[model samples]
Target chain A: MEIKILGTGCPNCKTLENRVRRVVTQNNIDARIIKVEDIMDIMSYNIMATPGLVVNEKVMTKGRVPSEREIHELLTL
Target chain B: MFLNPTKNREKAGIRKYSALWTGILVAIILIVVFVRFDLFERLENGVNWFVFGLLNLPADSHLASALEFFLYDSIKILFLVFVIVFLMGIVNSYFPVDRVKNYLSRNKLYGFEYLMASLFGTVTPFCSCSSVPLFIGFVSGGIPLGVTFSFLITSPLVNEVAIGLFVGLFGLKTTLIYVISGVLLGTVSGIILQTLKLEKYLSPWVKDILSKAQHEQEVFQLEKQSFKERLPVIWQEAAKIIKGILPYVLIGIAIGGLMHGYIPQGFFEKYIGKDNPFAVPIAVILAVPMYSNASGILPVIQVLVSKGIPLGTAIAFMMGVVGLSFPEAMLLKKIMSWKLIAIFFGTVSLCIIISGYLFNFIL
Candidate 1:
């Protein structure tokens, strides 16, 4: 599994990224998590809001941080 | 959206899309509703009694107080929004984006830098929408993410109306506290962002924009103009902004007016007042989707204050309404992804709640 966190480095964006990392670690998910900070790449996904989460190739959430349980569900699915 | 020349000419010739038509439509609707509901008749009767003070009224009655009860409250709010939106237009028109970018783009993101950026943002009269564009400009100019965050946090939290109202209603000490808290929130949030090293999460497009950026040095080089010339430009910009925001201002005023004249005092007190420990958080949550500027909502605040709502909670609600409205979040969705928008809302809402609690304790 692959998870990506996206934003332009605003505080909220950073917080979301950190939360994603924590959730990934705590759940012991066998996934490669990556952070994508570039604006163009994020825009290419047609997401206008930042601090987004992409699971695998699909965009999971935008402009928010999801709880560990939510991340776990996304990971499992 | 190809426009045929004949259709364009016919459309121009019709003159149907006029402000007068809009104004007339609004007036008709208001009049029809008031008449149908007997609201106007009641208002007339109420005014006469209130004005003459029917029961052994004092000879020297305060007309201003009476006027304030009915009209001034709404008028003041509309006026404040007008001034803010007008000033925002001026800042947008006159203040070159590159100037702000240059000032904030130092490579270092020290505490002092964060403080300065936050203070600068607080002083400048930029609305959230305008602030986003400037934030983008700053990021594009290679300003450190933490420093940029400082500016973004303080911009909406420490607006001019909020400061003035704090000073006027709550006195200097409370106003100072609000200002200090705003700065502290910005600084702490920025530091936290820096610590997380979240720059790596920014989308590649932003990186590309920043990497290719030769700073537009010429943009800020203003030629010295005579005061007369400058005045006209300022007036023109103010007029343009006023025209754009006038309808929204009026709508806010209308809602405020209704709340002032009709809403029962007990309602707000029962639900959202200081007696309820949960009021602060509940108000914050409710305020997230509602949109109103500081001025438009002042009348509601006035009623809430009179009805025993906690000052901190009321202000928090106001801040959430203005700063985190759903429209704002949605508008941002055009520029940011849904994930980013959610995070932004979460962070700002948390900050607003913290400030609310801080004010409640200190005040």
Candidate 2:
């Protein structure tokens, strides 16, 4: 599984990175998490807001950060 | 759309039209009542008193005065934000900036095109930090490098909130100078950069993004929509704008408000006054590090004006704050290399410092 965290290192982005990393570690899922920092690259995904999450090249969520349970559900699926 | 006269007089029936007129009348009456009663003033005082009660501080204390300014300015500035955001939604619904961009980008006349682009930038309302998205759109629309840079520079620097604050705080003459200088700076810098042929400095992937053949083009055919049909769309856009930007507005005003009441009077004059020849460059250099939304900087500017800073120096400082924001530069970094970003910063800073000293000398 490929998970991409998209942001430019704002506080919310940092919080999201922490949350997503924690979720990935606890779930023991075989997933590769990529942090996309470049504005052009983030724009290429067509997400409107920052702190976006992409799974397998498809946008899972954008703008808002989700909870731990939500991440787990997304990962397991 | 609010602009369709036909929907109001001809088709809506006498009863509906009468109701609309009645609504208008009532709104006018309420506004008159509020003004006559000085309700806004009363509300401001009420907030101040409430803050005093919460803190149990003396009415004449510095802390109390600071709290009052903070609360009052935050709420007042935010109210302006709401009204401007709503009106911009309605206006954009009719004018549709992207269409204007599409048509205007085709103009080969560099100087005139840059002027028009800068004017449009002033009209298009943004809360703050929205230059990158518009930059993407302009670049993708095939606008020239100079014209796009002019639009990008003018858009963020002379927004609705900034202009509104300028007019309210500094009066019409200063506002006029500001708008002209801002547009001039944008135009000159754009022409300079374009003449330099620095397109190679852009991140190469920008081409890939432009050529990707994927942009959503489903602008609702507003010309076809009945008046009733467009109302909800305007409302939705306004709501989206508020939801997206209110937090930034509130936080910005909050910080600015604190600075408003707390900062000592004559602070600028002591440091970067007209008497101090190095003030303009020093003020410009100081502004780059203190990043805040343009709105956040408004209250501070308010305090600056009240502090008797030289007009040119203060405006130079404001230009510095809005034009030289660190985050904004960083955001642009993804699309351009460090060198280009530095040039962009250096060009604008030099322009602002020059304007500062020029305004001081002239005005």
Chain B TM-score by candidate, in order shown = 0.66, 0.71
Q: Candidate 1: DockQ? A: 0.03
Q: Write candidate 2's Cα lDDT for B1-363 as tens digits.
A: 566897664554554445445435654675588679986688787886688876678987776777777677656555545555555555555555565566565555645887887777776654233456556666776676777788778876776557655654455688889989998888887877778776788788776555643433443232444435555665565566556556666665566556666777777677666778987898899887666555556555667767767888888888888766888877777678899889888888888899999999998
Q: Can you tell me which runs of candidate 2 are displaced by over 4 Å?
A: A1-77, B1-64, B95-97, B108-110, B125-136, B164-177, B205-268
Best by DockQ: 2
Each candidate: RMSD: 16.5, 7.7
RMSD versus native structure for model 2: 7.7
Model 2 Cα lDDT, one tens digit per residue, A1-77: 99898886766567778888899898788889889877777777755456788889988765556667878888788
